[model samples]
Target: MARGLIKAKMLPEGKEVEFEVEKPVKVSDLLKMAGLSSETAVVIRDGTPLLETDVVKPGERVEIVRVLSGGAKV
Candidate 1:
């Protein structure tokens, strides 16, 4: 089976993660492969927000971000 390699970068932290898996996999699967929390992470494929079921193609650059939480620091 063909496979795709993707790299994920964490914003504000500059952390990079690499993932390798079969091609035509869902974004959700990529998240899992990258060891990220699906609920807290927002995914973007090729500069576009992607759905969980969205198919990830080879050589496609993907980004993953963790939702920030902070308001009126107390």
Candidate 2:
């Protein structure tokens, strides 16, 4: 069997990245691989949000959105 790469589109930057995974891994783990913090980012697939514990298999496409916080003091 051959391994497939995981494709992820990083938000804000709108850049696509790819990586290989021998087996299914947690969304959080993937974030770490992309140098993203789970606390500030989220994994979404098929237009749905995925939990940190959600399993991400190889050859799957996912979107990583970085949640930003800002407010105008009025």
Candidate 3:
């Protein structure tokens, strides 16, 4: 089986992490490989948001932004 590379840019730290996949995998799978939870992080490619069911192609770069939900109740 061939291996594919998925480059991810993590938020807050603005660090880049790379993961290897056997082939094109779903966003959920990619997250699993990266050890990130779907509820806390969102996957984006080409400035567009990707769903859990969306497929991430080989050698693609995506950003993983952590969801921030904090506001004044006022």
Candidate 4:
């Protein structure tokens, strides 16, 4: 199994958390493993947005940003 790192924005606290992951898995799988919902965040690798079906490689660092929508009227 390969190893990788994931930086995700945690909810409630909105803090960025770093966690390790075993690669050869899809981005969606990784999110599931991390207890994160795919609908809540997006996966980015090497400054590029990756699809849920995209495979993450070992030693790769991915960022998970929370998807925020809706804003107060100005």
Computed on alpha carbons, the lDDT of every model, listed in order, comes to 0.74, 0.91, 0.87, 0.73
Q: Which stretches of candidate 2 lie over 4 Å from their true place?
A: 70-74
Which lDDT tens digits does candidate 1 get at residues 11-50?
6477877677666678788777767777888788768888
Comparing 1 and 3 on lDDT, the stronger one: 3
lDDT of 4 by residue, 1-74 (tens): 75666665554456777667665778888788767789887778767888999987655666776677568767
Clashes of 3: 0
Candidate 2, position 14, lDDT: 98
Best by lDDT: 2
Model 2 over residues 18-53: C-alpha lDDT tens digits? Answer: 989888889989999989899999999999999999
- Model 2 clash count equals 0
lDDT of 4: 0.73
Number of the predicted model whose TM-score against the real structure is largest: 2
**How high is the lDDT of residue 52 in model 2?**
94
What lDDT does model 2 reach?
0.91
Q: In model 3, state the lDDT of residue 48.
A: 95
